[model samples]
Target chain A: MKIFGINLAGPVREEVERFLASNGLKLEKDVEYTAVAVCREEIVGTCSFAGNVVKCFAVRPDWQGAGIAAQLLTHISDILFSKGITETFIFTKPENGQLFSGLGYRSVAATPQVILLEGGTANIGRYINEMVREAGINGTEKAAIVMNCNPFTLGHRYLIETAARENEQVIVFVVEENRSCFSFTQRLNLVRQGTADLTNVIVIPGGRYIISANTFPTYFLKDRQISVYQELDALIFARYLAPAFNIRIRYVGTEPHCQVTNNYVEALQKILPSYGVKVCLVERVKSKGECISASRVRQLYEKCHWEELRDLLPPCTYDFLRNYPNPGSQANQAD
Target chain B: MDIKHPAKAGSLESNDIYVMVEPSSEEGIVLELDSIVMRQFGRHIEAAIKETVTKLGIDNIRIVAKDRGALDFTIKARVETAVKRALEE
Candidate 1:
């Protein structure tokens, strides 16, 4: 058998789709690289990696236990290492957990239908421990909030303020993924600046564990799969993140616009409670009888509506926007 | 010797082992090993890895080994290859 890389488009793509479909799997659109093992020009096994997360693994039943899967995985790992990505994650079915476990993949979280596994240089335990150490977390009744905060807005500030007032300590995790309009560093800095006044609030990077491309690949996914990914993401938060920081309550702004955010909030509500964490839905703050949102702020900024944008954002965010050169051109540019 | 970058060698197959080596922030060698025969030969495999790394004079590194019943010689070779690759400029 020969294992080689295959482009995601063309005849090879069709063969992979057919092979995966025959094995009760569908190709996710986010796959960046794929490798297939072929025997006599027939696809025997395949694996793929997208942004450090590995998925869409299928080995023909007749070829199972022939070490084709291991070979495919090694190919993917080589590609990832060449790209300088040390951390890797995989989403697979529950039954195949042992197979991957033997290959050095450790279980991060698992549900009935799907299981999240991670390998390579970094793992969740070490990540959380490092974060806890750096943040200087104390044994207080802590609450949690995870937000992308594309640009820190008044709405986000309000949600954080409410959590800070209610809980003894509020751990705000700024999403570390750089897929937003603002870069991760800019977003993280804006959050730290915005919440600098709250004595009990500690802002930290969400790292690769929270709402990342690996944990929640919300873009270009079917509606059903979005819910599954959301649940998996939520389970990671509940089972690992919350307990590590002693966070008993999670605060989220009620989503009235984005269906994806609504589903995520619903998933959090459904999963966190069973894990001894309560979900608090804070009514979104409004400006002039309209709900204030980051997307709205982006729109106003794009339109150069400084007067309107001024009221929607906090002073820190507004100042940052005013000083930012050509903010609109930076939209959708990943850092 | 120092591991300047994260590097890996070998494959996850029967009678083989996968070795990953990276520079560690702290001193000393940090090893994480998983083997099918861990209950039987875990100590022997660990000794092989340590001996190979020590011979290479790598003092501060992190090694992750997933063994599928590889012999001591195979383990040493994979570890040596991975450490050397990591040391490459």
Candidate 2:
């Protein structure tokens, strides 16, 4: 059998579809590149990758024991590695997990039936290293704070300022996923402007590794498996990302209202210390004895509580709230 | 002893290993080992697999070990299970 790369078009696409269909799988439209293992010029096995994620991987039953799957994976990973995409993910049944694991993929997340395996040795480590190099910082007392900052509020600013005061350098990883009411770009701009006075605080996109859909699925929505995902995300941060940056401390605002956020902090506490990263929860900034939270700002926006929102947010956030129409109004309108 | 049928044990879970055992007509044990810790402890891991196979008295079989940083005990237990399952009457 021989392996060759094929574009997702024409006779090769049809052969790929038939190969996948034979194995009770279907060719995914989202795959960017695919490699096929051919025997007698017929596709016996197929593997596809979209960016770093492996999709539509299958081998015919007759060719399963011939190591065709491994060949296909090696081909795809070689191409991905050449393109500078080392960290990859693959989804497959629990039974075929050994086939992938034999090729250096480690299980990251799993259900009873399906398992998600990461195909790189140091994915998070590479990301943190790249982030540090890009920022060009080399300080022993570096700390970090990961925040969504739907809209940067005084509480968020207070956390950053506190971190900046305690550490020589503070890396603020704004969650880059655009799943909130405000887009990621908007949240990032608000965070930058809100903390412009803090010289030690360096803001950067968290990319797809921090609180990512693969690592932390329930960032905005609540789910039964929220705690599980939270622990995994925290573990990734404490064990890999933190050390790559020489981060000694992680600052998080205490969550008096959100159980999900509080649970996440608890998970961080359970794992971070073992990895030599201290978890610090600065109390949320309060106004008139009420804790300030981004949720409260979102709630105020829904109620058009401009006066109350002004009390909770910093001047920049207040100005953004005043000028940008309330997201609630936009949501209320027919699409 | 010879593996009468193909069988698998353990998982590809983090810090775990998966072992697949199949019947083979070869004269001696044939083992294919892969691991995340292959660079650091490949020899030790292979020795553990061979030791387990020897202790189980299974000499003629094809064993595939997909390791994800499992400890010695886990490796032994999984190898034992796969061999036993493959040799089931």
lDDT of 1 by residue, A75-106 (tens): 88888988998789887778999889888788
lDDT of 1 by residue, B22-77 (tens): 88866899888888898999999999998999999999998888888998789999
TM-score of 1: 0.90
lDDT of 2 by residue, A1-335 (tens): 78899867767888788877777777766678988888887878888887677888888887776757656766776577557664577756678787776766776655454565776422444446667788787766789999899889998988999999988889998998676888899999999998888998889888756763223432113326666666667777776678777889999898787887888888889988998999998998898899888878899889777788888998998888777876665765533
Name the regions of candidate 1 deviating beyond 4 angstroms: A9-11, A212-215, A218-220, A257-259, A323-335
Residue-by-residue lDDT tens digits, candidate 2, B7-87: 667665567776767766457877767788889999999999999999888878877676879999999999999899878
TM-score of each: 0.90, 0.58
Query: What is candidate 1's DockQ?
Result: 0.72
| CA RMSD (A), model 2 | 14.6
DockQ of each: 0.72, 0.05
Quote model 2's TM-score: 0.58
Worst 10 residues of 1 chain B by lDDT: B25-34
Docking verdict class for candidate 2: incorrect
Give the residue spans of candidate 2 off by over 4 A.
A1-87, A90-97, A103-123, A212-215, A218-223, A325-335, B1-89
Q: Pick the candidate with the highest lDDT.
A: 1
